[model samples]
Target: MRYDTFLDEVLVKVKTYLAEDGTLASSRDSKSLAKTSDLKLPLEGSDLSSILVDIDDYLQKCVKTNHPNFMNPLWGGLNIAALAGEIIATLTNTSMYTFELAPLASLIERSILERMCEMVGFSNGGGTLTTGGSNGNMLGMLCARSRGEPLSQRRGIDGTKLAVYVSAESHYSVEMSANVLGIGLDNVIKVGCDDDGRMRPDKLVEEIERSIAEGQRPICVIATSGTTVRGAFDPLVELSEICHKNEIWLHVDAAWGGSCLFSIEHAKLMAGVELADSVCWDAHKLMGVPLICSAFLIKDLSLLRKVCSHGDAAHYLFHDETESDDLGRLSLQCGRRNDALKLFFAWRERGDSGWAKMVDGYMELAGHLESLVVEDPQLELMSSRQWTNVCFRFKAEEEEDASELNTEIRERLMQKGNYMISRSNIGEDVILRPVIANPGVTKESLEGLVAEVIAHGEDARRGIPSA
Candidate 1:
């Protein structure tokens, strides 16, 4: 086939995939799929026609994340404008390291970062687009370390003496950051949370004092804006006050819930966020941009520059004239992709008002799901509804094991491929977490999900195996 003909065929496939209301995914196991897939890699190259067959097989097996039933992850659905930007970025094939190579791309990235900083109330602040929230959190801790021990960048510090604090419900990335920073996991204190899963300020204060008493130097307090399982927001105002009193850096991991800032009604959830020293927000999460589009904003841009500063080893890349404009100077990476274009396209298409509407709609849908779980006699709401994550479980009679029964229901849902929601544990109880981040999710979608859970629960109780 001709190149243009091949391109046309791919476009047709994309259109058909978007319009179809098929199963969320194939029910085959990984071993089964591997056995059936075309895995041979011969010395001879395949023609364009053969490649089309491979593409069709791949598409047929892949999970339909844009489908209305796909509530398994924190992100779903598709943005047409952002998709265009992604394709354009790939077509251009330029590195984001230097302004000389990606002039327009560099400016577009800077503009997006500036607006995000402004929304977070960071005046004259700046940030870089990172791989994801994990890298962003690591950058935040690295900055804190540089601030605490200014010479630590050149001369390493005793990580055993340095300590970091986080909520018990904070993302696991905090612990990963600790490990990467050479701060032992034992020194990374986990502050207690209240009944609502929010970090208790009193517990944070207590932990800070205890660390100080133990000859440990507290460098940073990493507060969470939106927790992973429960979607709880820590008391930022109180946490900021505590950090300020102790002279420690405050980094808010708003990766999951940062889009709440776009909504006046929900922005109050992260009140006093401006007081934080640094923050990381993922547009790919609540904003519905593609994956790996996260920002790490710092109130003091110079601090970030200093933390990321490497000696003038690459004289080939750095020049005095374009030094200020180069994004590599502010990043830990040397060569990065143009992740900004997709986010910029999405943001421009949906202005702040559009984002507010999207956030508000998701919250409304989450509220609807919560009501369904509460009203049902066999269902239990595991946690308080905060953002768009509804954690619930199916309850059975005293004779049946509730946790096992719920697990069976989730396995059955996956086997049938009708819905794809996460199965998580809150405390000792197993809960089904169906987040409403997908724009395709509707009131009817959630109602069907609730009904399916009850039906599966009944089957499991009666000792009926999953179909």
Candidate 2:
């Protein structure tokens, strides 16, 4: 087959699949297609026709993340232009390590990073793209550790006990960063959160004082902007003040909620983000770019350059300091894909206002879901959400366990191929967690989701078997 014909066929298949989705994927009884199917590598190479057929077969059982009914994960909504850019990058097969290799790509990445730093209100900001939010968080922690102890990198974080602070409701990546950076999990102190799931600045200050009294140095306080399940933005203004007063670094992990910068009305959610020493923003989340497009932005450019640049001066790849713009030296990743092209093309097409509207639209859908939960007698809102996630549950009889019933209802829904929303445990209650971030989804789709969950829950309470 011709290249154009092959590409057109694949696009048609994906477009058709996305348009008629009741849920992201048809339920397969908890078994994976990869294990069940005859997908094995052989010594012989398959023809183009056979390869295309295999592609179709693989997608048939795969979860359609781009589908409007997909309310499970943080990222949703696919941009055609950005997809085009991904395709173009793949065709070029270029890595974004050196300007000599990817001159245009390196420049585009710099432009995107500069714009993000400006949004973060950094005067002389600098940043590098990371694999994802986890990697970005690690980069922030590494930079903070370096700042706290200048010789720690060359030697080690020995003799001195260092501590890291974050909200109790922050993403687990904070703990992971500590483990990877040798700060140890015991020293990673989790501060308390307020009723709305934001980090309590008072508790943070108290924790820092306690750590200091114990002779443990509090190096950095990590704040969350849109937590994993609750979608809560930490009290950045208050936390920044505390960090500044303590003479410690403040890093805002805005992986999920950083898109607030795109919206003028909602940007106040991240007020005082400028005060943070460093910030991590994921364009792939609310901005709806492709996956793995996260930036670790630093307020001080010199710190980023000093902390990240540690190449042994590879002569062939990096000839001289003149080509300092080569991104590999400033990143943990070498031979990275051109992820910036996806964001750059999408930015050019959407512009700033367009991006803002996209964020507003997702938040509007989330608010609609919240209202639905509030009005329905069967639904109970687990947390007061300020962003895209709505955590709620279907009510059962007084004698029945609501948590168990909710779990049964979700499993039934998945088994019966009805709708797909994740379940999360808030304390003891298993709440239905729906992330309304898909731009193509509508109120009608969400209404159907509520109705189906209720219907399933009612049936399960009466001991009805799942379809």
Error of 1 at 368 (Å): 0.4
Q: lDDT (CA) for every model shown? A: 0.92, 0.86
Distance from true position, residue 135, model 1, in Å?
A: 0.8
RMSD of 1: 1.0
Q: Write the per-residue lDDT of candidate 1 for residues 399-418, one digit (tens) a residue.
A: 87888988999999999898
Identify the runs in model 1 with alpha carbons over 4 angstroms from their true place.
none
For every model in order, what is the number of clashing pairs? 0, 0
RMSD of each: 1.0, 1.7
lDDT of 2 at 261: 87
